[model samples]
Target: MTVENTLELEHLEHPDHDVVVAGGGPVGLMLACELRLGGARVAVLERRTDIDPTLKAGGINQTTAEALYRRGLLPRAAEAQERRLAEYREALAALGGGRLTVPPKFAGHFAGIPLSAELLDAADPAFDGAGPAGEVGAVLQQDVERILGERAEELGVDVRRGVELTGFDAGADAVEAYTSAGRLRTGWLVGCDGGRSLVRKHAGFAFPGTDPEITGRQAVAEMTGTEGLRYGWNRTEHGTYAFGPMPGRFLTVEFDGPPADREAPVTREELEESLRRVSGADVRIQAVHSATRFTDNARQADRYRAGRVLLAGDAAHVHSPFGGQGLNLGIGDAMNLGWKLAAVVRGEAPDALLDTYTAERHPLGAWVLRWTRAQIALMRTDPHAGALREIVAELMETVTATTFLVKKISGVWHRYDLPGPGHPLTGRSAPDLALADGTRLADHLHGGRGLLLDLAGDAAVTDPARGYAARVDTRTVPAASPEETAALLVRPDGVVAWATDEPADAKGLEEALSTWFGAAA
Candidate 1:
């Protein structure tokens, strides 16, 4: 049974939309934006009518931040999140430690371990290694939902809140959905509903992965004896305790294992006891405002698409909140799947193109799961792991080691193994290098179309781009990089489909265009 307040839907049975997305959270909303951008009719069915106001946790990694910027939603996204992470870190460092110092952040953290700017700079040597290769920002999850929802609406996506998908019947061509809002049919249905996804379960998708072994909790409360309860992550023999950027906001990880009752409420007395046990301090809780429990339970769907029904976000994968990658991962899923799915829906690409979604994202999802698993293992209270953690912490201070991890955590290193001649830039996020005239390479992708960026102003690149004139946008800009980057063929999702460091080769470029964008229009 669904927990949302149910309402009677008007349509009993009918093909109402090209796509019907189940779950209107940030992931679903972002997909709606992408679909709308592709001129596809999309609808989002959300279970919640109102946004959750609780300040549980907030932030997005640099990778997702770039996606928002590419779509011109960065202004709105910036308004939603305050990138005051440095302030938050400063507060924590002030708690008690050596002169804990760090460079300006370019990447996010893993288990409270910071990835520095110097590391990213050494690897790319561009962007001055200051932040994620592109934009890097953070906002509360609720604000993320709000901004994406507004963007979806702006793109004309139909969103119906307070309606939940109970089940769906999938066929070779379409999906027949049964929801609290009645019956509806769409050419495609994506389950962004969440971890305990009704669609995934009903569709018989195998969700096989590790289960939760530890329980993490966050609470906001009125408390006394705030002494020694300063900001920063602290480890105890029992577990981990962290106090905050704001007063009375606290978090603890208890190694007693996952809660027997995952649904049980966190009471004030229990919160106080946990604080005392984890911190080994006599902290007293006076009143509790709100609290939630989570675990490191990692899981992923064996397949992303099951016939006409699909899955994204928590429905497709779930992991511990160690690095703040869960939401970012889901948003990335939406961004990657949106354009490809829309192209298939609009008959601009063949059905086989849809299969690549799993081919690209499932490995990324698996990596996230392993990444969180490593965090869990490192953050444990066990003595052996504690020693290993100290070694890693020390190693993170080095240039090469730190740079490697910075790219990993920032997700800038994610490169799909696409069909290419192994050009270093292939299958990577197209560099947002600026031309002599001051236009950036990323700007050309704002329209969500393929781009053949000619850094050399080469005639060779423009000719093939003309073959697929309707699908690819060709732009000749001044050579923007110190290295040889003659031209880059970029997919709408901003991944490099092909690249040439010397000069554009017509045959190579044409093959890339046809492989990704289809036969020249």
Candidate 2:
């Protein structure tokens, strides 16, 4: 492709958009959808001609599902997952006669940590069921993008494919993005582009981190005769090799082997030979899909925002796919910033709401990187690491240790430290409570609205100056037990902001509004 063809810029004079998102991947599309729902005119600029073929980032955690569920997008997500499961089953059935059964569903606990399962069960009941044990956690990345993109389009988001952002000028008042087609002027510019983000580079943000010594390789292929085996892994003195059923009569293999020489392509014969060596059997292999190699680099940007241009997803952090967190983390990043950005753009909240994006997400990214590195270290075949891996795996099989590790990997153990006194709901996900007006917390939060639970006497809570606050709907539940009477305040991001028997003092209520609901006085 020529330079012009590769960087096809489509410009719009006085574009009708409040935020111009530079990337149409899952994170970008989801952010666009959220922004549109929050009453922002949004546009997405994507460079790809079509969705990626490889099924990357398989699992979607409960937290992510709850986020989507609150947005009323869970039905779509569930449909996509159902389709993927059916495809997986068909693929397995075609290989032989025995029915391919989905594995028992267990909360992903890492390192034999007992806390992980306990945390997950306590957080959400959706995870309380028998299912699969493998990492086929959710639908593929492409399927997620498809669903998000469709939902975004339905929400009146202008998704411009085949267009790439070349440069952006972030000024005090507005951002002028220069793309392959033309210039787009918007209130803000967010870079949801991948790790090799042009926007991040143009913004001059430094990505500070180191790459792991081992390289990860993944390939999807159709083998003539490898049936009866659900999934298997070979951990030899040299390296680690694993393969499992894919969507078609295909199997996906992942190998932690020696890094290939500079930009050298991994041949089909090499993949087949590796399968033979690892499986210890003769297998007919056809390269239906090519193997791709990537380094297990863990890095995050020095900062998430430079003036008005901000970074999220792979633009902000990159790490190994150890916990199947790459996509989930990206979606969470979009969720964390979407409502805050909407509040700022609408002048409902102070610019300080934007500050929390980095404050909150940066730490989570660091945690993910640390845990992913630990998992990678445990999986290494080096003689020194081998001894450590055996000890760690053995320890992980224990209930307590396994649960702790599981929580870390599943991301259920994370709790945001919001400014509030100790309450059951504080710093946790707000429980879905039904209101007197027949509206539930999830229903009201469909469009990224902050909610105040008035469990105290039904004294009206109102702010005449703030439209959202004045129109805030309060639900009064009859006092049951002392445990049930505690009120909960939920932020737009679905995190508990404040909880008490009555409203905090006027000063506390005012501060909560100022921090989350964009009330300024």
Per-residue alpha-carbon lDDT of candidate 1 for residues 201-244, written as tens digits (9 for 90 to 100): 99999999997888888887888777756456777788887775
Residue 206 in model 2: shift from native, Å?
A: 1.5
Q: Candidate 1's error at 250, in angstroms?
A: 1.9
Q: Which stretches of candidate 2 lie over 4 Å from their true place?
A: 1-11, 97-100, 106-137, 224-230, 245-267, 277-281, 289-291, 434-440, 455-457, 460-472, 477-485, 501-507
lDDT of 2 by residue, 2-113 (tens): 3533433343765868899999999999889878867788989888867877647766875677677778777777777888878777766775634345544545533212
Best by lDDT: 1
Sequence-dependent TM-score of model 2:
0.85
**Roughly what TM-score does model 1 have, to 2 decimal places?**
0.90
Candidate 1, after superposition: displacement of residue 236 in Å? 0.5
